[model samples]
Each structure stands twice: as structure tokens, then as C-alpha cells.
Target: MKNSAVRLTFLGGVNEVGGNKILLEDFNYNVKILLDFGINIKDYNDQYDRNEVPNSIKELVKLGLLPEAEKLAIINLYTDYHVKKNQDSNDLETNLDGIFVSHPHKDHFFGLSFVNRNIPIYTGVFTKKIISAYYKCSKTSIINNYGGLNWKLFRTGDILDIKGLEIIPVHVDHSIPAAYGFIIKTSGGIVVYTGDFRMHGPLAAMTQDFLNEIKNTLKILHQQENKRGEIQKPRETKVKLLICEGTHIHKGAIESENNVEQNLEQLFTKHPFDFLLVKFDRLDWDRFRTFSSIAQKFRWKFIITEKDAYFYYLLNKDEIHESMKNPNIIADDHILILTQGTVKYRWQEKIRQAIYKEEKGHRLIKYNEIKELDSGFFFYITSLRKDVIEKLNPNFRGAFISSSVDPYTEEFIDNNRTLSRFFRKIGIPSYRVHASGHAMPHHLINFIQSVNPEYLIPVHSDQPHFFKTFFKNSKIKVMIPNKNDRFELKSGIVNGSGVF
Candidate 1:
């Protein structure tokens, strides 16, 4: 007999904002897939820090860090090293089909470092490129090495058929490029998983495209329902389940991408600093582009670290979005790549070779020698590299601009506090000018109503139960799952009642 239900197990990403890992299993087709295997920031921080990482998969399992294999039931997910250390005889095989990554954020894809290399990992074209470039250039190979993993790339509108299931990847606007949401067709019904998205970014039109596609999907599913001679009302919902991220549930106002650029420009115009020290996420090319254009307006030399230069070279090599393309590292004169530290990695050699192919000498700058330069310069540095500011001329008026996501975890809060103290000790003022990568509360409300899913599952949120209040009067049933809870979908409805 064919199984008529699809089982959804919430392994992670329940009442938290970051680490997202959900398991989907099709019993009829014998297919099992993980939506996104991200790390739980608090759990990881409790056990280890940046300097220490789990040495083996067995260690992670022993510490309750990775998913419980006994609960998942699938086999062959670990390496030989783990199997050798395992006491159970059933731990010697692998059954995971694939892992679908929504984006290249550390919380979304960083857990790949622990996954078995044989299973295929799927991502958007640019997501693959960005992740590949990051692991290649980063010195911390112990944490994010993804070299030998099976990588499969997809684009918007491409339907991926795994066994008897079909998954369609659609572009969505977020802080990083190549972010996507999945429209999955299972034996049970049609399901939609909304990855982290926003409506206020420069590429908001892409998110609209996703919305329009979902509406179209609703029409098609409704037509099919009628063809099956199923007795239903005309106002029946078409989609079975809608998995959403409610990161900013209580926040009503959102800072748009344009607002970030305008605020930075206005702030700098009012209080002119001799030099600007800007810290932003490396994957956020949108923020980088904003700073790059600001450099042109002020006619200041934009300096990036070696890692940023490597990312620049990698992204520029691909056919990227129009808004992300500017201040070419090879063709532009105002852009300079900074070299620091005496030790050079294998990736740095490739960057030097690429940069040397176009220009001779003026484009590359030494780290210690930047103090000898004039006042008009924008230093694009990371939070870890704040010491670069201490090397600058003490008398040169400088201000620090933080253009990254707001603090959520304890580690992030502490890091920001430490950064502020360091800036205050040096007599340099620090300013925060950033836009969140998640959607605002109103936008999420509109999104849920537009889809009108029969069941709504909230993940990647600090207050998942707040969704109940958001849709109290609506017909949609909100399902707030606990970690490791199993929910089954059958006949276009979920098998569980409202949690709250």
C-alpha cells in the first residue's frame, strides 16, 4: 500500500532565530531530505568557541550537538572515522539523500563542515560559488572546509526531481545574493518553505516574483483538486503547509536598503571623518556596493582586506546581479586590495595572480604601510580585524560604522560590546547603520494571508508562539512545533492541533 502522508520532523530551528534543520520524509517514495542543516549558535557556544571545534562526528553526537541518529532512523550519514568509533552495528551506513541550502549565511550552511561528504548538497549557483570561494580562501579550514562534498547547483525556475518528489527553487530578496525559497511537491500535497526573505531590499522585485509564483501554484492546485472530484468549498485553501521565518515578529518598522545608504551618506556629510572604518558581513555584497559607491562620491580610496579581495575576484568572475556589480577590483583605480600578515595561504596566491594580471603596483597596499597614506580612505574591515585601526595615525579623525545584522546571540552581543569598548578606548566614535535581512512583521502578515495556507509552521524565530497572536482571527491553523516533534501531512491538512 502507498503511504498517503508526508512526515515532517523538526530537528532544529523551532523556538530560535538561527540554526535551522528540518527533515522531510516521503514514505511512499522512500525519499528523505533535510531542508537546511544549520548550527544552533547557543548550543555550539556552550560547548566550544572559535578556537575549538569538534574533532569527530562521534564527539558531536556524544555531546548532543548533531541530530540523534536513532531518532532520524536513516543510515550512512557519517564518515568511516565515526563508524569506527560507534558501538552500535547499525551506524555503518548512510541513507540521507541530499541537503538543500537556502543561502550562504554561516547559520544556514556552516554545519556542512560536519556532514558526510558522500551525500549531495544542493544550493543556488551563486550560493555554491560564494561558499566555495569562502572555504577556499579562509584560514579556518577546520571549521568550514567544503572541498570534497558533492555539490549540485540550481537556478530559479529549475525543477529538481529527486526520486518521485519535485522541488522548485525560487529567488528571494535577502542580505546576500542567490538566496531562495523552495516549492516542494510531495505525495501528500504541495508545500511551501519560505527561507529568510525581506521586502525592503534593492532586489525586492525578486521576492515579489516568488509571491506571484506561489499564487500561480495555488491556482494550479485548486484546478487539480476540482479534477479529482473532491467535494470542497470554493474558498478552500490550496496549499497544504507554509513554513515561514518570523525573525522580526514584534518589530513593525524596517530600515530599507536605500535608507541605509542615505543614512550613511548623510551622517558622513555632517561629521566628516578623516578615515572611515566600516565592518560588515563578508557575504553581504550589497553593503559592500553601497560603501563602494560612497567612495566614488567622496573620491576616497576604498581598501578591502585580502579575504574581501578574494571574494571580489570570485563574485566578479561570475554573472552576478546588476546592482552588485561596481568598482571592479581589476579595472577600477580607486579600489585597492590590502595585504596583511607575513603568512600567505594557498588562496592568497591565486588572488595575487589574478590581481597582478591586470595592474602592476598601485592596486595592492601593505597593512602596516597604510598609516603613511593620506586621510581620504575607506577601510573595509571585519570585526575580528579591528586592530587595523590602531595602526592608523592617531591624529587622523576616524569613525567606525557597523553595517551588519543586529545582535541576537550572547556571543554577538558580547562581541559588539567589546568592539564598542575598543573604539571608545581609542577615542573614535562608533555608529550603527544597518538593515535587517528578515521581513518586517507587517510584511510577514501580508505574505501569510496572500498564500492562505491551510497550516502555517513558524521556524527560525525567537518567539514562534507569537505567530498564534498574529493569526488569531484567521482561518489558517498555526502549528508551533517543539524540537524533535513529528508532524504528518495527509489529505491537504496537518495531523496536529494548534500548539498554543
Candidate 2:
């Protein structure tokens, strides 16, 4: 590691969409920071062995989920090498400087559970709350406990001055709220990392605002090159590298959330049923809002799982009523169905009290009342409970909307095929409706052009080469970065070494 070069190492987020682990090294100032250490959600141990999970940091590094940081300047909280209790007093501020998280997605933030609690982790406020909720509620072991981490909840424009590198979180719209893209000031130049953003969501303006800020910053840097010291000279003027996500490159373009929202209203109006069902992804709050808006517009009742109801309230506190906010403890006698069964999980016992009450007249309702009604209401159901599919009436005309990923992929097709058979047997019809949360090809091109970086490295994409073809003969040099490829950035020229 030389003093003049800045290094960008890709540990996982290449060729595949998740399992993102990136290391950003500032050799001149002896600073090392990890961007995101996340395991792929799609590759989660749903059908596999839970016993295979690593209980310690050494196992994590061995599994390639995290990179070895012994030579790294900072201390890691989770790893044996950097535990505060074992460290000598003189070597306290080891090599690692800080860790910046883009969002709370499992692919980006789940790995934080294994991170050294000593490292200063920077993220958004809402993202922290969501992660805490997820860790507390989820039955899956993949979501490690986040109780021990050192968190510095950075806002939209907060600049993180770690050593000599300046990192800023710029808000961007995604499936989950409080998603962000980052602008890092390094010795090589300004580097922008887009952490899974889309320009068609409700907060599309936020993404635009990020681009505008980048443009302004680049303009400012281009105008002045401070020659105060040799140390400061290499870092001055304009952005050198743009590390972006191309999730939708070859996955086909999708309409914005607005289109999906309108379609949902039309679907509800066309087929009003006794009990409509929709599969739920806990983090997909935009989808929840879409259904909520439909219920409000049609004057129909909408209910959600208590787990989801909590997140919904967090997202829509302004729209929800204060009276509906109750401590989710000790079930009420009024909740007939939720009380009938002996609930084992703490969340299960409190779910009825948490989600059954009326909120702003439409936010929360009970399953008992909805099933008794003749028609005109739908409720959200968790996919974990497969028995729920069996409980639907065979003669009912209710519709089930699969707003999450369709059965197009191999992993889901069989389950969905079985679900299709069950739905057909029951008389409840299912509908597929969803809008992707990633930028489309045209949108990607527009954003790339707007930032106008000297070098472009695509991450979280299956077809990174598509970017090369799309931006062929353009000013942007598209480099398809591979896994574990250490990129040394010196004067904006990126050279790679296949070393850990």
C-alpha cells in the first residue's frame, strides 16, 4: 500500500445483484473504510442449513462475506484482530477509519451485525430504525443482531470527515425510504457511489437533487485546484470515478410506482371481492402506500400485519391518527381471531393490539371483521405462513396480488405454480402487479451522462457489459469491475490487481 494511491476493492457486489462488500482505502492518509458489507438476500438460507452460519468474524472472512483487514489501519469491532478488550493501548486506532452504509437493505446493511462495534458506522435515521425493527422481529438468522454497533446517524447532506477523506450521504428514492447515494472526497478526486437508486418513485426529486449537487460540486472543483501541498494537489478538481448500480440494465424496463398505483386502483374497482390478499415484503413501503391509497380512494378497508403496520406508521405518521398508536402489548378481547390461538412469539401476541385498531379510518383493521363482511376489503399476508393459502375460501372471489417478484425465476416458479393450483381450486384469482425499484436503461444513461465521470465502474448488475455497449464511443470509460479486484486509483487512472 503506497502513500500516493487510493484503492477501491470489490469483495462481492459484481456480476450478481446482492452480497455487496466494498473496501475504500486512502493510503496517503492511512484511512480505510468499508462502503457496504451485505450478503445477498436471494442467496439467503431459506431452504438451506442454518447451522452453516458463521458465529464469529473469522468465519465471516473465511466465507468471503468479509475481506481480511489485518493490514488495514483501523480496528474492527467484531473481528478477533480488532476487539477493544484484546487491543494494546498503543495500537488502539489501528487502520480502519469509518464505515458508511447507503441503505438498510439486507444486501447492504445485514453484514453490519458482524462488523466491529468500535468502527464509526454512518447511515440515515430511518434506515437505523428499520434495521432495528427488522433485527428484533425477523425469524431469519440471516438478519444478525445490530444492538452492538457504533452508529452515527448521518442526515441527507451530512459530511463525514474521516481522516482526510470526506464522505457525504445524498438522499435517493428506492423501494425503502431513506435510501442514499454517497459523494466521497478522496485524494484521487470526488467519487460517487449510487446505492441502488430509482428515479421513478415518489421521492424521485431527491435523486434529482443528488445529481444537481454532484454537478455543482464538480463545477466548483473544476474551477479551483489548491496547490498548497503535494498531499492536497492530487485530490483537487472534478470527480474521477463513478461507482453505480445497473440493476435494471438487462432485466427489462419497468414503469414508475405512479403507474403501478393507478393500475391497483383500477384492479380494485374492477373486481371488488370479499377478501383480497397481497404478498408482503417488509421493506417495500411504497407498495404498502399504493394499496393504502387504493383503499382510501375506493372507500374500502385495508389491513396489514402488525409487523408491517409498525413500519407503515413510521413511514406515514402524518397521515395516521394519534389515537391508533397503541403500545403493542397484551392483546385486547375485541381481537377475536388473533386471541383464539395460543401465540408463541412475543410479536404474535402483540400483533392484534398493534394492527387491529382503526387508524385515520383506513390504516388498520381486523381479519375477523374483514372475513365476516360480504365484500370490498383486502388484507396483507406474510409469505412465511404457507398455511394462509389453504385458509382462503374455495368459492370466494377474492384476488391475491403478487406485487413482489413474480414466479419467473426458478426459485419461485414452483411455489407460485403450487399457489396457482391452490388458488384455482379455491376460486380466488391471483394478479401480478409490480414496478421495479431500479433505474431503467434510459434513466441510467441520463444519470450517468449528468454526473459525467471520467471512469465508470458498474456494480450490482448481471450484465455489466451492457453498460459498455450502451455507452460505447462515449466520454465515460466503462470498466466492468470483477470480484476481489483491487483497483488502485492514482491521478484518476485505475489499475487493478487480483489480490485480497
- For candidate 2, the 10 contiguous residues with the lowest summed lDDT are 327-336
Maximum-TM-score candidate: 1
lDDT of each: 0.79, 0.67
In angstroms, give how far residue 49 of model 1 lies from its true place.
Answer: 2.3
- Residue range 53-117, candidate 2, lDDT tens digits: 55666666666556666534345445333333234322234356667788877788777766655
Tens digit of lDDT per residue, candidate 1, span 1-500?
A: 23578999887788887788889998877889999887777777779866776776778777766787667886767544232222222224468888999998767776787676677898998888878887767554446556566798999989898997889889999888889999888888778998889998899999999989888776876777777766466655367889998888778555887898999789768776888888777777788888888888888988888777877877787765555457567777788888876536777787877878876457888977878879889887666565677678877998888776656641222355667778888787888888988899999999998988888999889887778998989988998988888888876557753353
Model 1: CA > 4 A from native: 1-3, 81-93, 228-237, 320-323, 341-343, 409-414, 496-500
Model 2 vs. true fold: TM: 0.82
Candidate 1 TM-score over all chains jointly: 0.92
